[model samples]
Target: MCSLEKRGDVFILTITGDSDHRLNPELLDSITAAVAQVKSESTPSTALITTAQGKFFSNGYDQAWALSDPARPKIISKKLRLLVEDLISLPMPTIAAVNGHASAAGFILALSHDYLLMRRDRGYLYMSELDIGYPIPRWFVQLVRSKIGSPKIWRSVVMAAAKITAEMGVEWGIVDSAHNGIEATVEAAVKLGADLVGRKWGGEVYAANRRVVFADVLAVLGSDETVGDSGDADVASVMNHKL
Candidate 1:
C-alpha cells in the first residue's frame, strides 16, 4: 500500500496505486506502519516527504467498506485522528508533495505536514464533505483552522467545497510552492527536505516545537468526543445520501 525510501537524510513515502487511494483500515494501517518505521530510523537531521502515485493523493474514506460495517466509520475516524497526531509529533520535519487531488480526510492528511508542495499541471486540494453530505469532524476543523491562514480561504474550502488549484493554494498561503508535474513536485519537496535536513536541528526539539504550535489541534485529536458530539453524524448518512 505504501513504500518508504531513504535518500541521504530524506525519507520519501509513496502511496503506491493508480486509483483514488482510499483511507480504509488496511491502507491506513500500512501507512501508519510506514510512518512508525520512519520514526524508528530517523536521525536528528532526517526529513520526510509524503507523496503518491496516480491521479489521486487520496479520495478520503472507502465509502463502500465504511458502509459495509456498522462500526467501521468510527474505526476509520479514530485511526485517522491517531495518524494525524503521530504526524504532528514526528521527530523530524515533514512535507507533503501533493501530486494529485486530496479531498476531505486526504486534505487533513496533507495539512498535517509542516510544509506542502503541489503539482500545478493538474489536480486540486478539495474539501468534499459539504458536497458529500457529511459533517466535518471537529478535529478536522481545528486542524484546518490552524494551518490555513485566511478565513476566506478556509470558508471556501470547508463551506463551499472549493477545488483549490495549485496556484490558488500558494497565493492563499496554504501551499508553499507549485511545480509543473508530479515528478517536479516530488523533486521540489526532496530539495526542500534536504535543505531542512542541512539545518541539523535536534529532532526532539523540532517535534516539541510543533506540538506547542499545534497544541489545540492535538487536544482535539486526543479527545474522547464521539462524532455526533463533534457535529458529525454516522458515515451511513453519507453512504445513503450520496454513494
Candidate 2:
C-alpha cells in the first residue's frame, strides 16, 4: 500500500498493506503511481515521510507468494530492490516515519533513509529472513554498516533475525529518534530535515561529502539482489518459528 500527499514543502509517502499485512497488489499500478507522483511533484529540497497505513509497515512479501511459488520471491524482491535503491538515490531527503514494525526487506527499506523516526508503541522490528533460512543481501549488511560499525552486530541481525525495540533502535543508531508517538516523531523528522537543508551553504560541498562517503563503497555493492534466494525449505523453516 502506498499513497503520496503534499505537505507544504514536503511529501508524505505512506506504505499501504492488505489485511494480512502484505503489499496490496490486487490492483495494478496503484503504488507505482504514488511513487511517480512524489518524484514528479516534490522539489529536490523537499523531505519524504515513509510511514504505513496500518500497524505494520509491510511484511515485505505476501506469505502466500513467498511460501508457495519459489519464483515469486525472486520476482518481487527484484522489484522491491529497485524501488529501495531509487529511494536511496533520490536527490531529496527521505525520512522513515516508522509507524510500526518493518522487518526483512522492510527493515532495510527504513534504514536507507537520511533520517529515521519511529513511534514507541509500534510493532516489533524483526528480520524474518534468517528464521526462514534466507541469507540477506550484502547491501543490507552495508546499510547496517553505515549506521553500526560492527559486522558482528549485523551478522546477528542477519543470522538470528533479531527483533529490536524502538528505543533500542535509537540507541543503536538504527533510527535517528524514537518518540513516544508518530505525530510528534513526524514533526521532529521534518524539523531535523529542514534544519539540515537550511544550514547547507553550497550544494557542492555537501555533494562532495556525500560522494566521498558513498563513492568508495558503491563499487563494493553489487546488484541489489545479489544475495542468494530462499527456497521452499527456507520459507518453511521460517514459518515454523515463534517469530
Candidate 3:
C-alpha cells in the first residue's frame, strides 16, 4: 500500500497502485511502518515528500470496509488521527505532492504537510464531509483553522464542500504552487525540499517549531481527552446506508 525510497537527503513516499488510497487498517499500518522506516533511515538534514499514483491521491476512509464491520470505522478513524499527528511532528521538512483528487480525510492528510504542491491539469482538493452529512470533528476543525489562513477559503472548503481547483488552491494559500502534471508537481516539491536543506536544522528543532505553530492542533490530538464528538458513529451510519 505504501513504499519509501531515498535519494540523497530526500525521502520519497508513495502510495502504490491507481486505486483510491483508502485509510483502512491495512493501509494505515503500511503508512505508519513506512514513516517509521523514514525516521530510522533519515538524518536531521533529510526531507520527505509524499505523493500517490493514479487518479486519486486518496479518497479518504474506506467506507465499504467500515460498513463491513461494526467497530472497523472507529478503529480506522483513531489510527488516521494518530497518523496525522505523526506527520505533524515529523522532524524534517515535509511536502505533499498532490497528483490527483484528494477528498475528505485525504484532504486533511495533505494539509498535515508543511507545503503542498498540486497538479494543475486535473484533480481537486475537496473537503467532502459537509456534503456527505458527516459532522466535522473538533480536531479536524482546529487543523483547518491552523493550516488555512483565509476564513473565506476555509468556509468554502469545510462548510460549502468546495471543489478547489489547483489554481484556486494556489490563490487561497491552500497549496504552495500548481504544476502542469504529476511529474512537475513532484519535481517542484523536491526542489523546494532541497532548498530547505540549506537551513541545516536538526530534526527535533524543525519538529519543535512546527509543533509550536500548530500547538492547538497538537494539544487536541495528543491530549487523549475527547475534544468533542468524533463523529465515528455518524460516519458508520452513513457508510451503512450509502456504501
Best prediction by TM-score? 1
Higher-lDDT candidate among 1 and 3?
1
lDDT, candidate 3, 1-243, per-residue tens? 998888779899999998989878999899888887888887879899999999989888888888877667667778888888888888899999999999888888899999999999989998887777776677878989998888888889899999999999999988899999999999999899888887898999998899899989988774322222456555457655321
lDDT of 1 at 242: 28
For candidate 2, the TM-score is 0.78
Cα error, candidate 2, residue 13 (Å): 0.5
The worst-scoring run of ten residues by lDDT in candidate 2 lies at 20-29
Off by over 4 Å in 3: 222-235, 241-243
Indicate whether candidate 1 or candidate 2 has the larger TM-score. Answer: 1
Candidate 2 error regions (>4 Å): 17-32, 200-212, 215-243
Q: Candidate 2 on 1-243: residue-level lDDT in tens? A: 566776666677766654424532331135446656776775545666777766776555565655555444555555665565556555566688877878776776677666778888876677776776655666666667775666676666667677877887777667677887777777777777677556543433443555456553344454645324535555455433222
Q: What is residue 132's positional error in candidate 3, in angstroms?
A: 1.0
What's the C-alpha lDDT at position 207 in model 3? Answer: 88
Clash number by candidate, in order: 0, 1, 0
**Global lDDT of each model?**
0.88, 0.63, 0.84
**Best-first order by TM-score:** 1, 3, 2
- TM per candidate: 0.95, 0.78, 0.93
Query: What's the residue-level lDDT of 185 in candidate 3?
Result: 95
TM value for model 1: 0.95
Q: Which has the better lDDT: candidate 2, or candidate 3?
A: 3
